[model samples]
Structure formats: C-alpha cells, structure tokens
Target: MNLGCIVGLKEWIVPQDKAFFDLFEQMADTVNEGAVFLNVIINNYVDVQNQCHKMKQIEHQGDLIAHQVYEQLNRTFITPLEPEEISRLATALDDILDYIDGTTQQMYGYGVTETDDFMKELARLILLSTQEVQTAVRLIRKLDDPRAVEQHCIEINRLENLADVVLGNAIKSLFATNDAITIIKLKDIYENLEVATDKCEDVANVLSDIAIRHS
Candidate 1:
C-alpha cells in the first residue's frame, strides 16, 4: 500500500459519516413532533386513544431510523466518529421517544381526561428541550464550533432544572389531595414527564462529549 493511496482511501471513508448526522437530525425532528402531539393531547382534551396511536406511529418511525444508523455503522469499514460514541448518540436520541411514548401510554391507562397547569408546564419544557437537541445535533457536524454546541447543551440543562421544580411542586400539591388513586396516577404522569426532560438532557450531554473529543 503506497502512502498516497492510504491517505486517499481514508478521505473517501470519512464522507460516509455524513449519513449519521442526517439520520440524527431526522430523529430529532420526529421527537419534536411527538412532543407537540403530547401537548395537544393534554391541553385540548381530545380523544386520548387516537392521539396516543398517532404518537406511537411517530415513535415507530424513529425506531426504524435509529436502527438504520446502527446498521450503517456496522457495515462501514471506517467511520468519522468512534463506534462507541456513535452508538451512545443513537441510543440517547432513541430514548427521548421512548419516554414520550411512555408518557402517552400512562395518560391513557390512567384515564387522565384533563390537563392541569403543571402538566402544561412540563409539556412546554419537553418541547423546548427537544428543540435544543435538534439544533445541537445539526451543529455537531462542525465540532470546531464548540461554543454553539455548548450553548444548546446549557439550555437543555436549564430546561431540565425547570422541569424538576415543576414536578416537585405538583407532587407536593397532589399529596394534599384526599383521593389516593388520583394522587398515585398524577404522580406517575408527572414523574414520566420529568424523566422525558432528563432524557433530552442526556442527548445534550452526548453532544457535548462528541464536541469536546472532536474539538
């Protein structure tokens, strides 16, 4: 193997990594749509089962795209990113939808018919965090711009903090109510919302890791 041929081959292999970034951006967009659907289901008092079914479709699509990324990673001889980092990024993005799906399933199962102020607030935070995740993933291709990527991660962390406070206050009030079953149900829903925000933060953390290593 001549030196020039080796360098050219490596250059050709690097472009293949672009597919990962495209798929990641697509997944983030789907997550954003799922967040929007959740908010509508909670706020509007719509047909809960129907909304949940739609959300499931979105989740399934995200799963397919995630698997495609994994398959591509397996087949490629050389990747622009470390295999472990690519795997972590894919899993973190997939987990966001999992949390969203879990939230809707619980809502329908618990027979939640209306939305309270706390649920509305949590929904807002989830949407915002997903937006940040989308931006961060898109910017990740240009790791030299660490400042831009770090800003998104910082915002995600801030949103997660706000969600924690909302969950705490909501739980405190629920404890004061006399209906034990209702209390249990609301607690489960609130906790799931908080967990979804945490998952978004996880995605941000993964982006920060990639940025730091590449920059």
Candidate 2:
C-alpha cells in the first residue's frame, strides 16, 4: 500500500450507523442539553426546588437515550464502532448529565439559598466542555475532518483543567468562612460541578483515541 492510500482513508467503517453512531449522537445531545439546563440554574439561582425538579427531568431524558444505546448494542452483532467503544462512549456521556443532575440535587437538598461566583464559573466550564464533547461525537460520524475532532477534544481538556483551578480556589474561599456547615455544603456543590467537567474530559479522551486509531 502506498502512502496516499493510507492518507486518504476515511474516519471509520461505521458498519452499523443507526445502531451505534446515531445513538451516540443522541446521547451526546442529551448531555449537552443537561449542561445547558444546569447553566440556566446557575445563572438564575431562583426557585430552588422547582429548578432541581426540572433538572431531574432533563437527566431522565438522558437516561432514556443511554438505555437505547445499551439495548441497541446488545441486539446488534456488528456495530459501527467497537462494542467496548460503543458502551464506553454511552456510559461516559451519561455520566456527565448524571453529575449535572446530582449537583442540582445537592443544591436543593443542602438548602442552598443562592449561587456563588465560583459555582457559576464552574458551571460555565461544564457547559463548554459538554458542547465540545457533542461536537466531537458528531464529527466521528463522518470523520470529515478528524483534525477538527481532535481540536475540539483538546478544547475539552483545556476546559477541564480550568474547572480544576476553579474548584481549588472555591475550596480555599469556603475554608476561610467559620461556618463549617455552609462550607461543607458549598464545597460539595463545587466538587460535583467539577466532576461533570471531568467526565467531559473522559469523553474527549475516548474521542481522541478513536480518531487516532482510524486516522
């Protein structure tokens, strides 16, 4: 085989598009929606119980998409991607929304009356990361520009790093306060938001690996 043949190769074989790739896109879409809804809560900071309940509904939507991916995987013998890749991607995407919903749950359960700057910034990062993840997922479908997918993955990693820094500073600020109970509540919220970004990075890693393998 010549260099041109290898260089001109497409992104993926995609043996079963509907069974895997389409479902992956659906999962990514739901995750991004959940992140956006979380940002809504972060910005508005009103109707604690109501916002939490609404976020839970969005998370449930994500759950249904994830279940479709898993069920399709079990039924399909030949998949667009590797079986493990299909399963890993589905779970990773689901995890992001799970954390988003979980953080809102904590806010309501902890009786958080308001939001803080740190939490807002972290939620913003989570939103950015999830958007990147969705982009990468879509790119994988056609692999039109594998380089573009890699670039988006790089951005996701950068956002996750920023989330880490935000979490660190938020924790430091919390400790400065004398109210240990308040400190604990806010710290947990910050950590959950941070983890959502972490899951975004995980999705990025998987996308990068898939890109490289088929590049």
Candidate 3:
C-alpha cells in the first residue's frame, strides 16, 4: 500500500480503550442487578412471574450492551485488546446474564411452587460468583495486576466446584423422594442454577486469559 493509504488505515484503527471498558462495566453492572433480582425471587418466593419480568429487563439491558460491544468492534480496527479477546470476554459476560435469566424463567415456567434450600444455596453461590466476575471485569481493564485477576478467577472456579457439589447432593436427595412431578421440576431448577455458576466460571476463564495476554 502507498504511504497515504497506510496512514489512512492506521487512523481508521485507532484504539478506543476506555469505551470498551465502560461498556463492559455497564454489562457487568446489569448482570449483577440480575443476580440480585434472582436472590429476591428465591428469598421472597412471591409474585415470581413479575419478578422474572423485572429480571428480563436487566437481561435486555445486557443484550443492548453486548450489541454495542459488537458494533464498536466492527467500527474500530484497533482496540486495546485483541479483537478475539474482546469478543470472547463480551460473549462470556453475556452468557452469564443469559443463564441467570434462564434460571429465572425456568423457576416460574416449570411450575416450581417453592424454592428449596438447594436452590437458595445455589443462588448464593451464583451471586458470589458474579461479584467475583464484576471485580475481574474491572481489573482486566488495567491488567496491571494479573495475579489479582487470576485470584478472582480462582475463586470463581472454586465457587463453580461448590455448585457442582450442591447439584450432586440436590439430585441425590431429590431422587430419594417419591413425588415424581416435584422431583422433576426441582431437579430442572437446581440444574439450571448450577449451570449458571458454570457460566460464571466461563467468564473467569476469559478474564484470566485476557490478563495473561495483556498484563
């Protein structure tokens, strides 16, 4: 390419690092709100449909942020992080919100009449995992301390493992009973909650990857 073309290309690809970080933080904030809403649903166990409705709003907000990230990536060739890394991080973050919303929907749609102790415990783990996720997301912007981000990731993995144990015990206890329909419904709800933690770990993995590469 000619010098003029090369210069134009360079200008076209200027980094908007702050914009991406802001968008990610907005997304993380929205998801955290969803997690809180979920806890409300679990703890209150009333008007679940309406509660799920409110959580849907947060999920929609997260979708808008994810779309903005994709649009930003399309328009900007130069980013503070690699394009792939940006996409992965955004996708992973979005997935957590999606699963959170999924659990809310399942809890109501599957005709779950009450929240069990297992479900409550799973919700707590999800909230804790998202808090870690939020910290990691913010820390990733600077990557000055890769260890800090990795520490958060480690905690996230530990939470996910705890979720696994919760799921296993939940299923074991569920099968021991004879109420087939209740067992089916609660099992689905429990599994969905556990999967939400799995999504959190996915976010941690992406954050850890970004920190390793960028820091």
Q: Can you give the lDDT of residue 130 in candidate 1?
A: 94
Top-down TM-score ranking = 3, 1, 2
lDDT string for model 3 (1-215, tens) is: 89999988876777988999999999888888888888889999998889889988999999999999999999997898999988988898898899889988987898777888998899999999999988989997888899999999999999999999999999999999999998888888889889889999988988888888887
TM-score of each: 0.93, 0.91, 0.93
Give candidate 3's error at residue 130 in angstroms: 0.3
> Candidate 2 has which clashing residue pairs, if any?
none
- lDDT tens readout by residue for model 2, 1-215: 88876644432332557557877888888898888988899899888898889889989988998899888777665676778887888889999999999999999899888898998999999988988898899999877688999999999999999999999999998999899999889988999999999999999988988888777
Instruction: Judge candidate 1 at residue 44 and give its lDDT.
Output: 86
lDDT of 1: 0.90
Candidate 1's C-alpha runs over 4 A off are 1-15
What range of 10 consecutive residues in model 2 has the weakest lDDT sum? Answer: 7-16
Worst 10 residues of 3 by lDDT: 7-16
1-215 in candidate 1: lDDT tens per residue? 99999998876576576787888889899999888888887788688898888989999999999999999898777877888988998999999999998899898988988889999999999999999998899998768799899999999999999999999999999999999999999999999999999999999999998898899
RMSD of each candidate relative to the true structure = 3.1, 7.2, 2.9
RMSD of 3: 2.9
Stretches off by above 4 angstroms in model 3 are: 1-11
